[model samples]
Target chain A: MARLVEVDDAADPRLADYRDLRDVGLRRSLEAEHGLFLAEGEKVVRRAVEAGYPPRSFLMAPRWLDGLADVLATSDAPCFVVSESLAEEVTGFHVHRGALASLRRLPLPALDEVLREARTVVVLEDLVDHTNVGAVVRNAAALGVDAVLLAPRCADPLYRRAVKVAMGAVFAMPWTRLSDWYDALPSLSARGFTTVALSLAEDSEDLEAAVAGVDRLALVLGGEGHGLSERWTDTADRRARIAMSRGVEVGVDSLNAAAAAAVACYVARARSAGA
Target chain B: MARLVEVDDAADPRLADYRDLRDVGLRRSLEAEHGLFLAEGEKVVRRAVEAGYPPRSFLMAPRWLDGLADVLATSDAPCFVVSESLAEEVTGFHVHRGALASLRRLPLPALDEVLREARTVVVLEDLVDHTNVGAVVRNAAALGVDAVLLAPRCADPLYRRAVKVAMGAVFAMPWTRLSDWYDALPSLSARGFTTVALSLAEDSEDLEAAVAGVDRLALVLGGEGHGLSERWTDTADRRARIAMSRGVEVGVDSLNAAAAAAVACYVARARSAGA
Candidate 1:
C-alpha cells in the first residue's frame, strides 16, 4: 500500500518533483537529471503506472485519493497529499485534474529490438513540438503502426504536455530515439524497411501510390518549419507528398505536422491491408 | 496610400481593436461588436489583406513598416507605430511575429452561396478549441474541401489563435455558421450532399468504405471532449469512423478532431476523385 502523508506546507522538499510544472525549461533539465517524467490527471497517471513505470512519488488532493485508490494500492511510493490551493501554488497552475504522478524513466529499447516484429513504422525527425510529437504517436498507434523511430532532436514523448496530448498513447507505442541521425534513413533501408520521407519534392509521388507495394515500411516526417534535412530526404528509399489540391495558393502550403501524420498513417494502413 | 499614425501611448483608444488580445473572452466580444478580426505576423497579415479583408488598422514596430509597405500602400487604414515593448503592453503577450493587422469582418456568405459549386464540404459542430478549428480549416483547404460549415455553437474561426494556426487558411476557405444546429445535417442531405458523421457508432463503417461511393460529400466532426451529440449522430445520412487498430485498447479511443478531419478529408478527396 502507498504511504499517505498529509502536508500543509507547499515548500516541503518531498514535493520538489512537482514544482514549477509550468516551466518547460526547468522541468526538462530536472526530469532528465532525475531520470523522471510526470503524468498528469487520473487516467494518465494510472496508465503510466500500469505501463510499468515505477512511481517516484504522487501528488494530489484528498478528493482525488478515493478515485485513484486502486492505482495507489499497487505502489509503495509516498503520496503527498495537499490542499488544492497549495497544489496550485506548488505547481504554478491549477491542479485541475487533481492527481499527478512522477514516474521513473525506463531505458528505451534498441532499434533492432523495436523493429524485430514491426512491419509498419513511423520515423520522425527533428520535430520540436511536444503536441505534434504526441499526436503522431497517437495516430501511428491507432492506425496499427508497429513502432516509431525518433531522430535525435525530436521532442521528448515523455514530456508532460506530450503525454497529456497523446492521452497516454505514449505508454503503449513502441519507440526509441536514433543515436545516428545522419544515417537513420539509410540504416532503415539496410534493415529492409522502405524509408518513405514525407516531403513536397518536385518528383515526389502521391502518398497512396508510394505505399502501395511496400512490405516493410517506415514513414519519415520532418520538423515543423523547415522540413526534413536534405541529407535524410536524399537518402530515403522514396519521397512522397500528401496531395495538396491544385490551385490552393494561400495558407495551404503544407498541412500541420500532426495532420500530415494522420493522413499518411491512415493511407499507409489502408494500402498495406490491401497489399 | 494608407495614413501613417505614430502613437506612443499603449492606451490609445484607436488601438482598442488590438488590446488585451490574449484575453479570448474580451477579444471575442470586442471583435464582434466592432465587426472586426485580427491577423498576426507578416505572412498572415499579408494574406489577410490580399484576401480582401479591408484593414481597420495595422500595428507594428517601425522595423516592420518597410516590409509591409506594399500592403500598407494598398489600404487607407491607419498604421499605428509602437515600440515592440508597447506592442506587448497593449496585447498582454509578446507579439513575437512583430506585426498585427485588425481587419474588417465582412458578413459570411450564405450557406447556399458557399455550397453552390462545392462538391466536398466539411461540417464542424461545437468544437470549442480555437486551435482545432484552425487546424481543420487548414486540412480541409489542403485536401480540396470545397467549403466548411460550422454549427451555430462552434468556436469562431476568425479568432486570432485560430487564424494563426490556420496560417490564414481561414481567409482562403469558404465557411459560415449554420443558423440551425438541429437541422444542419439533414439540410445538407436535402441539398443532395451525403452527410458522413465521423463517430464511433457500433455500425459505423470504415471511413474509406463510408466515403467510397458518395457523390457530394460532407464530412461531419464533433467537439474535442464528447465525440458528437446524439441528435446530430442519429440525423446524419451515414456514420463513419477512422478505423482504429484492433487489439490495442489502452489509450487510442479516437483521433484528435483536427487529425480526424485530415484523414477524413484525404480519404473523401481520393474517393471523390475516383467518383
Candidate 2:
C-alpha cells in the first residue's frame, strides 16, 4: 500500500516535480534533468502504472485516490493528497483530470530489439509539436502499427500535453529516438523493411500502391512545416502521397502531421491484412 | 486600396475586433454581435480576402505591409498599423503570425445548396475543442471531402484558433451548422447518402468495410468525450469503427476526434474514387 501524505503547501519542495506544469521550456528541462515524466488523468495514470512505469510520486485530491486505489496498491510510491485548489496552485492549471503521476522514464529499448518482431512501423522525423507526436503515436498504436521510430529532433512524446493528447498511448506504444538521422532510411531499407516516405514529390505514387504486397513496411512522415528532409526523402526505398482533392485549389496545404499518419497507418494496416 | 491608420493606443475602440482574443467566451459573443470573425497570419488574411470575405479591418506591424500589399490593394478596409508590442497588448498574445484580419461572417449557405454537388461530407456532433474542429476541417478538405456539416453546439470553425490551425482551410471548405440535430442523419440518408457514424458500438463494422461502395457518403463523428451521443448513434444509417490493433490491451482507448476523422475521410475518398 502507498503512504498517503497530506500536503497543504503549494510551494512545498516535495511537490517540485509538479511545479510550473504550464511552462513548456522549463518543464522540459526540469523533466529531463530529473529523468521523469508525468501522466495525467485517472485513466492515463492507471495506464502508466499498468504498463509497468514505476511511479515516483502521485499528486491528487481526496476524490481521485479511490479511483486509483488499485494502481496505488501496487506501488510503494508516496501519494500526496492535496485540496483541488491547492493542486491547481501548484500545477498552474486546473487539475480537472483529478490525478497525476510522475514516473521515471526508462531507457529506450535498442532499435534492433524493437524491430525484430515488428512487421509494420511508423517513423516520424523532426515533429516539433508535442501534440502531433502524441497523436501520431496514438494513431499508430490504434491502427496496428507494430512500433514507432522518432528522429532525435522530434518533440518529446512524454511531455504532459503529448501524453494527455495521446490519452497515454506513449505508455502502450513501443517508440524510441534514432541516434543516426542521416542514414536512418537507408539502414531501415537494408534491414529488409520497405522504407516508404510520405512526400509530395512528383514521382511519388499513391499511398495505397506504395505499400501493396510489402511484407515489412516502414512509413516515414516528416515535420509540420516541411514534408521530409531531402536526404531522408531521397534515401527511402519508396515515396508515397495521400492525394489531395482533385479540382480543389487547396493551394500548398497538406494534411497536418497526425492526420497524414492516421490515414497512412490505416491504409497500411488494411493492405498488410490482405498481404 | 486600404486606408492605413497608425494607432499607438491598445485600448482604441477601432481595435475592438482584435481585442482580448485569448478569451473565448468574450470573443464569441463580441464577434457574433458584430457579425464578424477573425483571420490571422499573412496567408490566412490573404486567403480570407480572396475567398470573398470582405475585410472589416486589418491589424499588423509595419513590416507586414509589403508582404500583404497585393491583398490590401484590392480592399478598401482600414489597416490599423501598430507596433508589434501594441499588437501583443491588444490581442493578449504575441502576434507572431505578422497579421490579423477581421472579416464579415456571411450567412451560412442553405443545407440543400451545400449538399447539391457534394458527394462526400463530414458531420461533426457536439465537438467542443476548437483545435479538433479546425483539424477535422483541414483533413476533410485535404482528403477531398466535398462539405462539412456541424451540429448546432459544435465549436465555432471560424474562431481564431480553429482558423489558424486549419491553415485557413475553413475558408475553402463549404460548411454550415445543422439546424435540426435530431433528424440531420436521416435527412442526409433520404437524400441518397449513406450516413455512417464512427462509433465503438459492438455492431459497428470496420470503417473500410462500412464505407465501401457508397455513392454519397456522410461520415458522422462525435465529441471528444463519450464518443457519439445515443440519439445520433441510434439514428444514423450505419455505424463504422476504426479497428484497434490486435493483441494490445489498449483498455478503453479510442483515436482522437481529428485523427479518426482523417482516416475516415481518406478511406471514403479512396472508395469513392474506385466507385
Candidate 3:
C-alpha cells in the first residue's frame, strides 16, 4: 500500500520529479536523466497505473487521496500530501486536475516488435507539439490503428501536457521512435507494409482511393510546418491527400496535424469496415 | 491607409485593446464591452482584415509594420507600433507572433440565413473550449461542411485562440449562435434537414450509415465533458456514433471533441465524393 507522507515545503527534495513543470528544457533533461514523466488527475493516474507504468511517487492535495485510494492500495509508492498552494508552487502551474503522479517511463519498444503483429499503422514525421502527438495517439487508439511509429524528432508523447491532453492514451497506445530516418519508409515496404505518405504532391491519389483494400498499410503524416520532406514524399509507396475545397483566399488550406490524423484514421476505419 | 504611430510606453492609452490578454475573464468582459475581438500573428491578422472585418486598430512591433504594410495600406485603422518588450507588457504574455489586431465584432447572421444554402452543417452544443471550437470550424471548412451553428453558450469562435488555431478559418466559415437551446435540433428537422446528434445513446446508429445520402444534414456535437444533453439527443432526428474499437479497458473510449469532428467530417466528405 502507498505510504502517506505529509509535506508542506515547495522545495522538498523528495518532490524533485514534480518540480518546475513549466520549464520545458529543465524538465526534459531532468526527466531524461531520471527516466520519469508525470501523469495528472485521478483518471490519468489510474490509467498510468493500470497500464503497468511504475509510479515513483505522487503529489497532491489531501482531498484527492480518497478518490484514488484503490490505485494507492495496489502500490507501495509514497503519496506526498501537500496543500493546494504548495502543490501549485512546486509545479509552477495551477493543479486544476487535482493530482499529479510521477511515473517511471519505460524504455521505448523496438520498431520491429511494435510492428510485428500490426496490420495498420501510423507513422508521424517530425511532429513538434506534444498535444498533437498525444491527440494522434488517442485517435489511433480509438479508431483501431494497430500501432504508431514516430520519426526521431517528434515531440515526446510522455510529456506531461501530452499525457494530460491524451487523457492517458499515450499509455494505452503502442508507439516507438524510429532511429533510422533516412530509409524508414523503404524498410517498412521491405517488411511487406505499403507506406502511404499523406501529402499534397501531384502524384498523390485521393485519400479514399489510395487506402482502399490494402491488407497491410502504414499511413505516414508529416510535420506541422512544411509537411513531409521531399525525400519521404518521393520514396513512399503511395502519396495521398484529403481533397479540400478551394477557399485559400479566405484562409482554408491544410488541416492541423492532430485534425489530419483524426480524419485519416477515420478514413482508415471506414476502409477497414468495407463501408 | 492605416497611419503608423510609434509609441515607447506599454501603458499608453492607445494600447488598451491589447492589454491583459492572458486574463480570460477580464478579456471576455473587456472585449464584449468594447465590441471587439483580437486576431494574433501576421497570417491571422491579415485573414481577419481580408474577411471583411472592419479593423478597430492594430498594435505591433516596428519590425512587423513593413511586412503588414500591404494590409495596413488597405485599412483606415491606426497602427500603433511599439517595441517587443513593450508589446509583451501590454499583452501580459510574450507577443511571439509579433502582431495583434483589435477588429470590430460583426453582428451575427440570423440562423435561417446560415442554413439557407448549407447542405452539410455542424451544430455545437455548449462546447466550452476555444481550441476545439476553432479546430472543428477548420475541419468543417476543409472537409466541405458548408457551415457551423453554435448553441448560445458555445465558446466564441472569434476569440483569439480559436481564430489562431483555426488558422483564421472562422472568418471564412459561415457561423451563428442559435438563441434557442431547447428546440434547436427540432427546428433543423422542421426545415427539411436531417438532424443527427453524435451521441453514445443505445439507439445510436453507426455514423456512416446515419449520415449516408441525406441531402441536407446537421451533425450536432455536445460539450467536452458529458457529451450531448438528453434533451437534444431525444429531439434530434437520429443519434449516431463513430464506431470505436473496444479499448475502453485501457482508457480509450471516446475521442476528444476536435478529433471526433475531424473523423465525422472526413466521412461526410467521402460520402459527398460518392466513394
Per-residue lDDT tens digits for candidate 2, residues A137-181, read: 887888888899999999999999998888888887888889999
Model 2 lDDT vs. the true structure? 0.90
* Alpha-carbon lDDT, every model: 0.91, 0.90, 0.89
Error of 1 at A227 (Å): 0.9
Error at A253, model 2, angstroms: 3.8
CA lDDT for candidate 3: 0.89
Worst 10 residues of 1 chain B by lDDT: B246-255
DockQ values for all predictions?
A: 0.70, 0.62, 0.70
Query: What is candidate 1's DockQ?
Result: 0.70
User: Tens digit of lDDT per residue, candidate 3, span A12-101?
Assistant: 899998988999999999999999999999999999999999999988899999999999999999999999999999999899989899
Candidate 2 chain B lowest-lDDT run of ten: B246-255
Kindly indicate the candidate among 1 and 2 with the higher lDDT.
1
Residue lDDT tens for model 1, B82-137: 99999999999999999999999998899999999999999999998999999999
Candidates in order, TM-scores: namely: 0.98, 0.97, 0.97
List residue ranges in candidate 1 displaced over 4 A.
Answer: A272-275, B272-275
Q: What is the interface RMSD of candidate 3, in Å?
A: 1.4
